[model samples]
Target: MLSDFLHEYFLKLSIIVAVFGGAFLGIGIGLVMRAGAALDGIEVLALYTLKRTSFTITEIILGINIIIFSFAALKFGIETSLYSVLTYFAATKTIDYVVEGIQAYTGVTIISAKSEEIKHQLVNNLGRGITVYKGERGFLPGKFDVSADCDIIYTVVMRLEMRKLKNLIYEIDSEAFVFANTIKEASGGIIKSRVKH
Candidate 1:
């Protein structure tokens, strides 16, 4: 009977431990970020600006990277500077993912000509929903191309699903323009329930 009781509650116990562990990790990350933002008072200013305006955390990160890379390029060389750019991009994405939450949801926006096919795959195969925005798609800075109407598909998905979705998209339209960002919070929709036994 005791063995049966333990067996029955094992999953529950494990889940509890996992949740607590994640919470502690989150707290630790928060403290580290606070410390990071304290450096030279610039981070604090950036954080303040980020909190107030519509600017995303990524813009600030990329801005910092631009400065760092410029300095690195002068001090080191083009090779190290290029490597730093890649590293900075990865770090910024990671920070955005962490800052969003443990779940690390991502919002995907695809401006693909293969909208119907992509929609079908997402809805039927992946069981995901998407929002379509119909708008003009061209305004060139260099190339004088004529504007054309397009449908922009947007979907919110877990980070795990992001790669799969992107692959499916690329398989359909190789020239598709896709962008993704970590979502802070999501609720009340096709996003499946989190509660599990």
Candidate 2:
């Protein structure tokens, strides 16, 4: 009877460990993502929205977890849903650490007929270096003839300053075409930033 009781207790303990262990695993993944400057799995979707959409990063993240939990409830059961929600919250604080910990940097690409003018402004005003690449223009309708001699202008700047840079560039030349991207890993050339903020 004692052995039987011990076996049942151990089984219960194992089940409890499994539940919390899954949560701990999720939290660990979140932290690693926070530290490593990259996202894993569902986090990738959040990262994509962060760059491509008007939505705030936090909103995107929360929305994703909500969807995940809702799906889990639908497919698995209420228990899975509850666990997912709990785990998601536990993992979320890692985002704050990740955002504050990682240095945010922007890569700017400009294609303009007035590349030289923009380049000058970028150099003199922004105090940053830029690279120019020979390229064709006008695959897009409005983009055509904007630059007779096509050159691609590229620069990297801190994320905090990206808005100001964009506004400045627009102020200089509204017709100038620009693409901004978040750089997770940047090396070579003049782009140098701390791996973490």
Candidate 3:
């Protein structure tokens, strides 16, 4: 049996085995879900609970996992249960990463006086599409009565490109106010550059 084989060979390295095994299992399950298929009854049960209860799918699943692990701890030794918990945690995180995507996207907002130059450079250098919003600036304690029009630039970029984007923007305007948010999902935009072979 698989259990016996793992116990015989990996008993001493249980933690490592659990983590790797869980990661591989999570990848498989995530890919199946992404393809619009169910891998186990837990997913089905979660879906059923989702409609009748106010709890989200993740909450339902977590609740179920807690119950299952509690029972596991009661039946198995504490050490075994702890290893199982580690495996479960790794698997859950791996599943999220796999399902969401390895190449994460970040939504960036830039507020700058040199908006025109920054926008041009962003498009020409980064090949990213930008959305501009007209807004008022200079709203300080004493300057609340006075304001100036400005352009707020927004764009989505891959996580790997964040440093480059920051450098580029700061190079253009040292005083540019920039912030970013982690995007769960992004679509229907010029997200990918058009590459020619």
Error of 3 at 175 (Å): 4.1
Model 2, span 24-119: residue lDDT tens: 654666566556545555667777777888765545766787887887787899765776665555545455435544456788898877778788
Q: What ranking of all candidate models by TM-score puts the best one first?
A: 3, 2, 1
Which pairs in model 2 have colliding backbones? 103-197
Candidate with more favorable, higher TM-score: 1 or 3: 3
Model 3: per-residue lDDT, tens digit, 1-197? 99998887787688788899888877887787668677788878977886899764445765787778878888887788778777767776777677767678999999999999999988887888999999989766886878889999999998888999999999989999999987876889789754333
| Local distance difference test scores for all models | 0.71, 0.70, 0.82
- Clashing residue pairs in candidate 3 are none
List the candidates' TM-scores in order.
0.49, 0.52, 0.71
TM-score quality measure for candidate 2: 0.52
The count of backbone overlaps in candidate 1 is: 0
Error of 3 at 183 (Å): 3.2
For model 2, the superposed segments whose C-alpha errors exceed 4 Å read 1-102, 139-147, 192-197
